[model samples]
Target: MTDLESADRLTEARVALAEAMALHEQGDLVAAERRYRAALAQDYRPADVLPLLAGLLGRLSRPEDALHAWDQLLAIEPDHAVALHEKGLTLHWLDRTEEAIASLERACALDPDNATALGNLGVVLADAHRNLEALRTFRRALALQPDNLHLRHQVRRLGSGAVPFWHIPMMNDAPRNDAFEAAIKAAIGVAGPEARVLDIGAGSGLLSLMAARAGARKVVACEMEPMIAEMAQQIVAQNGYAARITVHAKPSTELAVGAELDAPADILVSEILSSDLLTEKVLDTFEDAHRRLLAPDALVIPRAASAMGCLVASENLAGYAFVGDVSGFDLSAFTAFAPQRLPIHGTMTGWQRLSGDVELVRLDLTQKKHDATLARLSVPVTASGRAIGIVQWMHIDLWDGVTFDNHPDGYHDGGWLQVLHSFPEPIDVVAGEVLDIAAGHDRITLILWPLPRAAD
Candidate 1:
């Protein structure tokens, strides 16, 4: 065709595409699909029209066609950000996560400030279980658009919920903190207040600053969570311990003994145990520290931790424990995926214990390694009721005299929550009978299992 004829055909194509979109807005998806394909046949860059066409196909549940259109567009415009973004989303819907991440990452890199690209990248990363990097990406998007509620929710959800309220008081638990302080003080005494110290998982930089307060010449602490680590660094300065403490933004694994520190640490103080213990990988962190970082006989804070619990029950909690059919139909099948462990506000959520507190899992931190083990324990019921499960907490035995824990009975309003290790279902029980439970830790997570009630 002549150039004039070619231009006329292009104008006609654009008009036809516009009419097709109007039809689409009028809910005539069939006509829109036809026009979109017609426009594609005109030898135009498919990438220009493919996004809308693919979106329409996806809306119609024709994912196969949508995928084909996107793949074609990608071939034409390899770095097309929209095409990459849409393709990644489609791939994710098709359950191809790794490829989706790669596509989304490419899209984000191509358009660094593209909020949609950043948010999509974050979502894809999170789906792939790369939670840390996902969080960073989400924050970057938020920095561009702070008012984004979706981004805000993702951040909150990714944080695994705010640290339970009782966690702080529990961390400050005198018995726990004093034990560690005593151990720390003793370590500093021998190290002559000049021994360099390394504190990993510096929640509040409390330990490193404590060492400095105790006269250590230098104490370095590392916290992986950026916000927390930054806060620690500031707190050190505000508390007049800045000169003595250095806060590093990293997990202990990221800290090289010689590079991040002058030499092997003379003493190591770290507290990163989750309520169940080891869930925070405290064992792994300490093992790595000892394997290559700490000197022999270096003081390790929280020499031990124990997961304690009581078979608990409350009418208020039964709703969370057992889900029976409304009219005796078998709706129980839906409850199979019920949470094995639930975090409840011990102070805010009113619940009564049907069984006395029992020591379940005890983690000896002094040990270098651990293997999972199951042991039988007979717990006596303290009150009569339907037993839902065991409400568990931790007791961290820190250096010398410091201690920290939310031992449900007395701990309230801190950064940790008493974990309700909900049973698979509820069990009716009477007072004076022993509730059998299985409890231990694989050096990572506290294990609590409700055993079958003996023949009722």
Candidate 2:
């Protein structure tokens, strides 16, 4: 084409672009879209025209078309940060999560300071259940924009959802914390200051910090939750124990002898137990740790744990255990679907013991191997009442002499709540009768079932 013809075409394209922007601002998206296409057809700065067209298409509720327009811009300018960022958003709108993540990640890499891109990437990652990556991305965005309240809220919100709700309460429980700390100090003392300590499930890096404060030279802690792990790192640094402690944001199963730790640790401290003692896969976690992360003779804190409880009878507790005749209708069948275990605050919940405390099951944490087991137990009734089920609590034998128990009678305001293993139906009995029950564990859950009473 001649120079005169090229200049004439450019003038026409500039006029069309101006008209498109004016129409778009006036809410006439259909007319604006036509003008944008006209400018693009003339190849009048396709890079700039494509973005405007893509954004207009999005406003027109044409996500697929908008995606294609963004792609066209990317084809021309591969590293265009705005194109990549906008394209990522369009892909996410289209439910193309993986592609969105890829585009947003590239945009972030191209413009490391783009807090918007980083925040969008974090949202996608979180939607995909890639919480660890999402948390890290959110943290990076917060670092870039320190005063961004939205970013700060995302960090805290995601962090809370990533970890269990009971963690903060557990940390605040003076009795539990004191017991664990005492056990940790004792273990460090016995293992000597040079002992290598491995703290699995480092919620707030409390155990690892305790190890450091006890003069351990090497401490390695791993938290599966990314947000918690990051906070742990900060807490360790704040406490001036960062130099002696290395926190890995991963599960104990992911740790290696030479990577997260210099060698097999001499002491293993983990508090992954659930209210029922085994629901948190404590067995699986500990087994994996023993096989890979700890020495053969590693000193394990909480060497043993036992679930103890007695037969319980409470009008208030019975209401939660079995339901029947609600508003003159028989809903006893709904009892079959009731919660097998109900967590209750011992001090607040109204209950009475029908039998003295009985050991339901015990786990030997120091053992190298374990398997699921079930055994019979007999509890002599101490009072005659309608037994709903057994209200059980934990007794952790930490170290040799340090022990902790949230016994339903005296222990209150702790993270450990007594769990009621409800029966299928209420049973009545006399004071001198023996109630035979089956109690044990299936490795992942606690088992408690009442046996049939013998005919008189």
Candidate 3:
């Protein structure tokens, strides 16, 4: 090429580069993108211009174009950290999470000290629902930038958000803890210290720690939630039971007899029951434990748990369970979406019992097998009122005599709240009339519904 033509081409590329910078500064992303591409076409420092173009494309909400620009830069400078980071962001915007993770990981490896990159990586991991990994990434970033409020917030959110709200309350519930410890001590006394105890859903390692404190030599606890499991491990170590208790961050179903446990556990201590007996899949978890993880004659901590409830009427609860007229509209149709069950602290909520406590369903955990069954329950009403539903609590037979119940009358401030099994609609009953209900479980959930009365 002639010297004059080359100089003209160089000047044209410089002009395009200058125009792109000016346009970008003016917030004219579309024009800046055109000038950037024009400069690149004229071969004016393609490497430097590519990042600006890619960023401009991203600002324009053109992820595909930004991705292409990033690829072009990466092809030229394969180890460009900023390119990789921005590319990861664009990929995340495109919902290409796995690719974004790979790119961000590469960028992090290249620039280990970059807290912003690490934080972005954590956000992507969280979006992918890889919570434990996200929490770890956020923690690493937080360690690098301790004073960063966003990093601190992310760490706290991922760490605390992964745990259920009931865990703290359940841990602080002295009565509940005492009851479980009593049951564990009783089991350990019978089985001896050599008993291998398996604790399913071991939140905070409380139950397993109790077992270890009660003289159980070997305690294997499994929590399905990884965050809670990690905390349980920390708590066990803090309580000096780390050597005796091993907390596995895996669901009970994933645990095998020889793998997580040396052999089938001699004692099964699981507090997987929800406010309502079966919502936590207690029956399924227990049945699986018996079938795989527990010895045939293993001493189950709660040998039996019965769901006890009474017909109730509560004005405060009615608002939560049913909705009728609003500002002016008949929104009662929205009642179809009302909650089937509502958790309530019995002492705190104002409710009147229409019938004495009736046994809705009973699960014998020692049976090793359970079938979903429903039967007729005749609740003898003692009060004339509008019955919303049955307010249910639990009566757990932990061992021979070690029993616990969250009876609404006096048992307050415990982890176990009396759940209201809300009905489809309110029923008005006479003082002496009997209310029939279909009461049982579907293995995973308790089935309680009002049955139509026979012809008057």
Off by over 4 Å in 1: 1-15, 44-47, 160-179, 217-263, 272-293, 304-410, 413-456
lDDT of 3 by residue, 1-456 (tens): 999999999999999999999999999888888888889998889998998898888888889999999999999999999999999999999999999999999999999999999999999999999999999999899889999999999988988788777767878988778888998998899999999999999988989999999999899999999988998999999999899999999999999977888899999999988889887888789889999988888999889999999999988998889999899999999989999999895443889989887888988889978998999999999999999999999999987777889898888776778898899999998899899999988888889999987887
> Against the true structure, what is each candidate's TM-score?
0.67, 0.89, 0.96
TM-score computed on alpha carbons, candidate 2: 0.89
Best by TM-score: 3
Residue 21 accuracy (lDDT) in model 2: 92
- At residue 331, candidate 2 shows an lDDT of 93
- Scored against the true structure, residue 80 in model 3 reaches a CA lDDT of 93
Residue-wise lDDT of candidate 1 within 316-434, one digit each (tens)? 76666667776868778767877777778644377777876678877776666667878988888878887788888878776555666777667666556778878777877789877
Compare candidates 1 and 2 on lDDT and give the better one: 2
lDDT of 2 by residue, 149-216 (tens): 99999888888897676777889898888898999898888889999999999989998988898899
User: What is candidate 2's local distance difference test score?
Assistant: 0.91
RMSD after CA superposition, every candidate: 5.9, 2.9, 1.8
Candidate 2: which stretches are off by over 4 Å? 1-19, 326-329, 345-348
